[model samples]
Target: MPVTVSIAEFFSSLHVSGQVGVTREALLPGDSEQTQALLSRAFQDACDDLPGGLKADLECCHAAATAAIHYLYRVCQALVDRAMSEEQVAAICAAMPPLPTSPGEMFSQDLALRHLPELWSMARSMSDSDPLVTGIEQAALRFPLSSVGIALKNSPDLLSLRRHDGLWRLYIDRIIARQDALRLEDASTALAVADALGEHAHSLAPKLAARLALASAPALSAPSILSLHP
Candidate 1:
């Protein structure tokens, strides 16, 4: 029978032997593949949505994909080792591609940075005080569209969903579906997302209604309830 080695041992062997004898199964974890696939799909969708279905800037896209893969690898390594210092976090952030200023750029950057929020959430659960967690929070703030699920203490003043091309609707929907109050900063944010959904996201309306009701019941502001009507 063949031998099986732990991920740590596999990496250790690479360091000692300077050979890549391990299989993809031994190297890329399942979640890594899933994340990669999601990025691929996002890329395809973005391309399809382009005018005349033309391709995007290949060089920019390649850089985004490379950055994402590198970031994911570093994060996984840190998590596995159960140790990530502030300096390491800072290095990772510095290596990230510049913040996207356009919708197209946002879609491309999101291919990898989208995972930051969930990774940050995981890190927070491990240690709320960890520099890794705080670093991720700051990183997430710069990518609000991709970080909609993350709750920031200082929420940005994004009053219009149109600014993000309504891309954040999906993340908000997921938050609402899970009944995650913390993910939404406050009632105002939730109401804004709900209003943006309008009739387009009918399925989420009831859930949104319930969430808003529960959130605003203490204050029960008439204006907040009326905004949900029309």
Candidate 2:
């Protein structure tokens, strides 16, 4: 999807046109106007306490929700394909945290992220010893995003974007390979998905950074790795 309409902007425009903010009252069936308003208001409220104003909140909310929604939709569809009912779907949804207001918010604010060890242990039997695509894949197991930064792109071959550098290229290919199974993009995939991606998949940041430091990308000043948002 080439970026769906930004719920925030859509809402702002509606306000400009004299429409009120979104609310439960606007969620009338088939009322596109009301539906739009609800989405905007919900998104706005979702960020009420975050640092930046509407725009920042929207960025976080949009990213997180998309990440959560994509996975949920896929799981939901598969279950539905198997003739699952609403209750079954609800059960599965119950397994995850509330849908994030945005992918960034989930990455930055969630506490479940600290449980990656538990997640990785669970995936040990599946990927058969860290096949690849580990870091980004872990996001799913965590069930929402937490900081998995652009540093993930670093690889020894990279001329810039040194953080993730070489290891990133290989991971990207694996991610491409696994994209069908996991409904995430590089930017949106979470740490849980990375850890739980394949049993063998180790967090790529350390491995990649060690390589770059060796290849003239400055030494590992400290034990380097992907920084999770706190």
Top-lDDT structure, candidate number: 1
Error (Å) of candidate 1 at residue 25 is 17
lDDT of 1 by residue, 72-163 (tens): 44654555454556786667555555655555566666655656666777788888887677666776666665665676777654443235
lDDT of 2 at 26: 15
lDDT of 2 by residue, 1-230 (tens): 23233334433443345232222111223344554455445555544633233233123243344334333333323232435454554454444545433334543223223223233343343443432124323343343223232112232222121123222333343333333223232223333234434444334443433332344345667887888999
> In model 2, which range of ten residues has the least summed lDDT?
153-162
Give the local distance difference test score of model 1: 0.55
TM-scores of all predicted structures: 0.56, 0.24
lDDT of each: 0.55, 0.35
